[model samples]
Target: MTTCGDGRLTCDEETIDTIRERVLSDVSARAPFDAVTGNEDRVSDGAVSGDARATKTDREVAVSVTSLSKRFGDGADAVTAVDDVSFDAETGSIVGLLGPNGAGKTTLIKSVLGMVLPDEGTVEIRGIDVYDRPREAYTHVDAMLEGARNDYWRLTVRENLRYFATISGVDPDSVRDRHDRLLAQLGLAEKADVPVRDLSRGMKQKVSLASVLAGGATVVFLDEPTLGLDIESSRTLQRELRRLVEEEDLTVILSSHDMDVVETVCDRVLIMSAGKIIADDTVDSLLRETGLHCVQITSTDLDAQIVSTLRGQFDTFSANAREAGYQIEVTTDSDGLYALLALLRTSDVTLGRVRTVEPDLEDVFVDLTAGDRTPGER
Candidate 1:
């Protein structure tokens, strides 16, 4: 056994795996409400549900943001970074924020993190206003931002965890058992003594994650957790995060451009654009609400008027100019496809190819953010 700085007699990395297995076994046997993850099949193969998790026992509100708004610059130069965004995330659920580059995803998360103050609205942790009660709010929250900046570069993985947990007011001795288990689960047992700066980007990120999970924080904010990792590394980290939420009873808010991570890990999704919340709901519900499936349409001498007519009916209509005419992909279902075909024949256009294709999250994302106005115009 190795002695930690806080005088805890804990088995160091050499024997952590064995201890972790015993700990996890005990932890996993709890009741459904107390199990590693309460939501059934919410995550599969490192992907969130296309439909989102269907059920979970009710839990108290973990984080609440009300009518939050922020702006930069002044007068004509003023640009709203976050526009009246509001949402509530319950304990043990993962909520995601997705949007294009300037869609205020970062600003919204920053406001919640207290990294940037919101010009309007309130942020609360377990109903305590974060802006008004930062010290108290921080006790229940921790975030792993991009770049693993939450961690100290020169500190060893074990050292970082001990430091962060203590500074967050968690007695190291009380959580020493968990601290070892986290190191094991993150695959850092062999390198627990290695300085964080000596590790790979993915390893450093995992170390950062270890810090977050060890704090006993009621809420966790992970900003682009998968940003710089490779495929396998990404998958590994994603799996760990899923387990952390389920087993730890921790609420999570995720911000990512990677829809796969968001869809796989999040119980609910909030889509941002133009400094405002344009969509908020489950991923499956959002896909269903789009009322769309793929139907490809190819034509010879495709009349411009017919394309215009189709556009009026279908929210998504993309046409590729061809030598003879054009090929169009329309987002609709079987019944609508038939109607479109009938309409095309009525217009006397020579159709080439028409068929259905699978739907993708990208499709839904495109549809949700589709608008003609450039960022400057808005």
Candidate 2:
């Protein structure tokens, strides 16, 4: 699916990947961030980690939100977007904020950035209270909000980068070097002279990222940065993001609906719903705690007896039939799929196959936020 707005095209999963392949085949960004094309060596597994280690001493807290709460209207119309949310992101780490639509993810970010003042609570950027010192707080933080409305459509990609770098206070002598480096890194070097209006959505997004980076702020906030990007473009941004965190010692707060990106990029994740922080833990920690417990069984056919047996053994289960066989799903603890296969064999049923299901971040998100009332209700 594709949606067009303000001359920008937002693509869904399949189409986005197809478009990305075409773009990379023609206009490569640069080495580190564009390795998806062919330069695999430049894609470092710990680029962000390396960057973070280099700036460990700079160790200043990047952003902190303590007991923050935001409410709109009153009585029947009341809506709380952030409910006493509090968290601290170190100077050199990538933290992801995740939630379903209307889950208060945007509200929390906006309050922290001083775009909307919370009814109660405080947001501090680099130790500067956003409410008390909005300007001062903003000075230490740079953000690429959804779609990042910063590009000069009339200017060429190169000219726009240079202009933003200059506005960001880059020294005139260093502007060209910085612009060229960014253009090459983001794969816009060849299109340096192409007007922004002519660029694809992914290209425009890269430009947005470059603009925020040019600011040299200690903390960067990216809301849904990969929402409409193809798999490869998303991967490239993740690599460069890690580079920034590991090498530049930059603190990044990313709010996105992309679980794959969150799983691969963030050091920790905060799950939000109904304006509250429901879960916060490292990616590994969440996985470990959740455990790998899924049951899979394939048989020539499933009888009502088997359905009853499965329902008795697990909280939830599903069954479906296809050409190969009938597939059954069940909740299990961290155990191999062999156990279920054994059960089928012992039952004297014609067992077709079995497999274990691995849990991903999306499962974690759905499980964690399942309790909240719909955001629309709030």
On lDDT, the candidate that comes out on top is 1
lDDT of 2 by residue, 319-356 (tens): 88667557887655445345555666677788567676
Model 1 vs. true fold: TM: 0.71
Q: What is each predicted model's overall lDDT from 0 to 1?
A: 0.75, 0.71
Candidate 1 structure quality by residue, lDDT tens digits, 232-342: 877877787788778656789888889888888889998887888888889888887876689877888686777778889876678787887788888765677778878
User: Model 2 — TM-score against the truth?
Assistant: 0.75
Clashes of 2: 6
Tell me each candidate's TM-score. 0.71, 0.75
Look at candidate 1 and tell me the lDDT of residue 285. Answer: 87
Best candidate, TM-score-wise?
Answer: 2
Query: Given candidate 1, what's the lDDT at residue 261?
Result: 88
